[model samples]
Target: MDLATRATPLATTTVHRAGRLRTGGAELSWHADRTTTPVVFVHGSFDDHTSWDGVVPLLPPGVTAVRYDRRGHSGSSAPGRTVIHEHVGDLVSVITELSGGSAHVVGHSYGALVSLMAAVRHPELVRSVLVHEPPAFPLLTGDPVGEPMRDAARAHVITVAEHIEAGRTEDAVALFAEKVAFGERWRELFDGPQRAMLAANARTFLDQFRDPDHYALDLAALAAGPVPITLTVGTDGPPAVRRITEILAERLPAATVHTITGAGHAPHLSHPAEFAAALARHLDRTHLDRTRPA
Candidate 1:
């Protein structure tokens, strides 16, 4: 993971278009409008709606970028002991409420996994999906080569979970940033607010792993679904992330792969302009003019 030639950080914009959606005994907080040509941005673990602050403002004019704080993170309610499907359901509900049934979904890490599951479960709600580094670890289980990777990943997960459970959330955040998100450069990359956000939501990361199907995905169902997909990876990311992206591109019938040069796990944060342009291209090629905003 080389950080010597990283792209200049984009200027952060303050978007005050905050709103809340009450669903299934929990409240999901989100930013931006419910306009036509909606592109919902789902943030990963230890993150909130502002994860897309750099990328959202750069999208084309016709595109409405909706970024939400996933349930139990940031401004969202923390209903105790939830599963991955609930996150999936929350995403589906967001799309239905804001986009009038269908929208382009851009997700990162765990959020990417949630978006894919929603597409598989309710294809009609997702016009297109552009996901970066979904940790679908179940896809690695049982294979001779993947078994070792899975084992190592499991150990890392347990260590992070233990740190959180022990109330060493700051340590957990630093450990995850070092091992998964950003290499040693996490401290340099994450600003004060970004680091605060990660620390604040550390417990939710542990809650996610409590679900039995946290990393499981039915590849067979995803392959049979009709939703278009653009699976993105960073050139300099961890090998495990690359492997998961390859697995998705191989298993999903309508999936295409995109690579961001000199970027790591969170390109939307590190390489905002490139990430945003890639998303815009995916949406434009979808030819969503039929549902253009009035």
Candidate 2:
């Protein structure tokens, strides 16, 4: 059932459960709403499983949305080290344990990168992928058109790093919000709980950012993979992010792009209904494609 046609409120209808998974030497906190089709959600840096609260409840009835706090964030164990490959392993483990080995994946920002890498590394375990702007900046290295964007990102990184090193995590989070996530009107966009969440996970963001290979992707491997990918971009998102998504669509043969009008980085937070509807469509399309004859 679509969001509008559904009579019962998700609060009353969805069954929520809490669970744990051990991966990459960290005990990860996971949540699931028991249903027919598993749809795992991967949240970006400086965020946690609660990031999907707005969207998951609104998803169609059959989707069992599973979301977990990544290592070093929220309830997960913080090992003081964050690596992209470990995150990919964590995602695969999550899928294996919670989703019956294969499931549709949806991710935002850094989580998007993890989900894409997981799809490439374990195509047999991924049904399909829906990702918002992944900060795969390495893809822009040699492109002349991306030089300016790269420069701007580097500057933002420097400033954010300075704040983090100075032990001003709140300041770093605010700077990130103003510059990348929410733009000029960030103060109005982020609420107290959301801001607290970002502030709390600030150090993890720095840890991930410092990893040299965190933003790298093997485009050739992803292109050759069988898993279908959907790259989602918000109309009001950062220009660099939009460019990265554009480059990804150009490179990945089995990938498609979708835009959410007037939304920014966290569309699931800012535009839950639209995001949920888009996910529902993706779920339907993947099911149809898999069931269709060759």
Candidate 3:
């Protein structure tokens, strides 16, 4: 119940490069502490490390949490091309370099998809992955609503892309806020504070949505790969996010799917306490599982 203790300030570290990879050089910003195993935070599309502002304070003691402005966003270097594999490779480099080999990876939205790819491609560099609403449709093949959700996601991406190309980032962002971020009922929920946060990070969001390969990756294949994974969806999240979470839970081996009550897509931001508590519990359980007698 002591939220104060969970609100420890995470010290920011300077940006560092993780050797040369396919996308030239990938850089990351890290926060290290003396006690905890490093937990790398990956931001979703249209956002940067700042997206983790709320949840950072809630992370457990000794945990080294790192967030990077995935290539082309914020302070990180952008190498022109915006392919998904390149982004995945950037993640691989960051994790391997920062965690000293492996890390507990947490990703939201598009970042979740990248995290899955990194885990699968370089399993040795990932201990466990906490994927929050990865938009992988094919994995939910059996679900009646799966196809529709995928179609919607695709359509949304295309619409946003066109808007961005036409130099209408504001319009694209507004439309996204209406249909995706705050759906019908919750539109009113994003009053003063939430709107401020969204507005501040609007540019990054626009850039992410406009990227060419944002929706081109094979999310299902990435999810099916061998990795200890945790899937989380907010109870009040959009139907598409919930659907994606369900599909991931069903497809991933050794995966646990959870719905955080009274939260939305950005639970880490909207409900920091609940988000931190759930993450802490998951990390504890994961540690126990790893040390348990086989």
- Rank candidates by TM-score, best first: 2, 1, 3
Models 1 onward score TM values of 0.90, 0.92, 0.78
Who wins the lDDT comparison? 2
Model 2 alpha-carbon miss at residue 114, Å: 0.2
Which tens-of-lDDT digit does each residue in 131-204 have in candidate 3? 78876555545568877776776687668767767767666666676676556554454555545544444555
Clashes of each: 0, 0, 3
- Give Cα-based local distance difference scores for all models: 0.81, 0.84, 0.67
Tally clashing residue pairs in candidate 1: 0
Query: After superposition on all CA atoms, how large is the RMSD of candidate 2?
Result: 3.4
Worst 10 residues of 1 by lDDT: 1-10
Query: Which digits, one per residue and each the tens of the lDDT, describe model 1 over residues 63-104?
Result: 667778898998999678767888998998899887678888
Please provide, for model 2 over 155-176, each residue's C-alpha lDDT reduced to its tens digit, 9 standing for 90 to 100. Answer: 8877887888788989899888
Q: Return model 1's CA RMSD, one decimal.
A: 5.2
For candidate 3, the lDDT comes to 0.67
Which regions in candidate 3 have their CA more than 4 angstroms from the true location? 1-23, 26-34, 140-143, 184-226, 288-294
